[model samples]
Target: MANTKSAEKRNRQAQKRRARNTTVRTTVKTALKKARETIATKDAAKTPDALKDAIRTLNKAASKGVIHPRNASRRIARLTKAAQASKAATK
Candidate 1:
């Protein structure tokens, strides 16, 4: 569809970036979901690790430019708050 050679190359690059971003976004979503479920279940053995993994994935996505850093930070804050609440409830 690109009439110019440069435009064609750009389209290719865009396609590659799109695929990469999709995978990263999927990973972030899955991690966040798992952490939320773990927190809800209040699995003392798994909660900390799940939250850590979700935070790490979010940070990686932000650093890779797939997501905004502040967005990731906000999600991390919410997750941490929920984890703390779960802990408090367990005590």
Candidate 2:
């Protein structure tokens, strides 16, 4: 319960931010899942595009402050490494 007006306003703002962050997080998760699935399925042609999308989403989230920059960077790095390893194995 926000007793003060300022506190009430802050609560409202927090709710809005929470909703926005949840949506962005969901998008990031979905993108990452798709990229991993493509890689695991050995769809070499689709893997790069999927990974690119995931990285893009992660960057967007980080830029918007929904995720930490380093967290996004780590995820991007891991996905890129996995894609490269898969490609090498296929060759």
Candidate 3:
């Protein structure tokens, strides 16, 4: 319960931000999952595109401030490393 008017407004703003952030988070997670799955399945033809999409989504989220830039970069690095390992194994 917000006792002050400003507090109430802040709460409302938080709710809106939370909803928007959730959507972005979900998109990032889904993209990461798809990319990992494509890599795991050894679909070299599809993995690169999937990795590109996942990286793009992560960058978008970071730019929007939904996620930290460093956090997104770390994830992108890990995903890229895994993708490379998978590609090498397949080769």
Candidate 4:
């Protein structure tokens, strides 16, 4: 428990930020998972759209500081590489 007034307020702020971060994190995970699934299925039409959606979510998370910019970049790069490889394999 917080011992001071400021501490109590800080705790409350932390809780709110935690909840917001969790929601953003969950959204990123869902987008990434869907993108991976789309890639695995090799649905040419769906793959690009899914990849774009995933990238967009990652960027948003990074911009919001929920995830590091470099982390988001790494994830985006890896996913894009996998998507490209999948496309090549199909061709």
Candidate 5:
């Protein structure tokens, strides 16, 4: 529905960016969920590895501007705390 040529070009660009951004968002969400599930199960052995992946994914998203750096930091903090708590509970 873009009336102008420039607008049409922008629309096309937006579509491409949206798809790319969505993939990054999906990665962040999936990593966080997997980390949380690992923590919940009290799998202390795997918590460190899972947390590492989650943090890596979060940092990647933040660096790519998909999410704010502060937001990513907060999520990483919460996930680490959860993992710690689960580890404590298991011991």
Candidate 6:
């Protein structure tokens, strides 16, 4: 439906960007989910490292503008707290 040349070019660019952004966001979310699940399972021995990895992933996504920095920070903070609490509960 993009009739003009410029419109067609813009559509192509938008599609490409959407695909890339989706991949990045999905990767970031998957990392976060794994970290959360690991913490939820109360595997204290592994959670600290998992949390570190999740935080790193979130920061990377934020830096790349895949997600907002504030949103990433908040997610990281919540994940950290949950991981810590899980560890504490198990001890």
- Candidate 1, residue 81: the lDDT equals 99
Candidate 5 lDDT over residue span 41-91, tens digit each: 988788899999999999999999989999999999999888888888887
- Per-candidate clashes come to 0, 0, 0, 0, 0, 0
Cα-based lDDT at residue 41, candidate 2: 85
Ranking by TM-score: 4, 2, 1, 3, 5, 6
lDDT tens digits, residues 6-89, model 4?
A: 999999999999999999999999999999999999999999999999999999999999999999999999999999999999
What's the lDDT for candidate 3? 0.98
Provide TM-scores for the models.
Answer: 0.98, 0.98, 0.95, 0.99, 0.94, 0.91
Report the lDDT tens digits of candidate 6 across residue range 8-90: 99999999989989999888888898898899899877887888888998999899888999999999989988887887898
Winner on TM-score between 3 and 5 is 3
Candidate 6 regions exceeding 4 Å error are none
lDDT tens string, model 1, 1-91? 9999999999999999999999999999999999999999999999999999999999999999999999999999999999999999999
lDDT of 2: 0.96
Ranking 2 against 6 by TM-score, winner? 2
- Return whichever of 2 and 5 wins on lDDT: 2
Model 6 pairs in collision: none
Question: Which stretches of model 2 miss by more than 4 angstroms?
Answer: none
User: How much is 12 displaced in model 1, in angstroms?
Assistant: 0.2
Clash pairs, candidate 4, are none
Regarding lDDT, does 2 or 3 come out ahead?
3
Query: Of 1 and 6, which scores higher on TM-score?
Result: 1
Backbone clash tally (model 4): 0
| Candidate 1 clashes between residue pairs 3 or more apart in a chain or in different chains | none
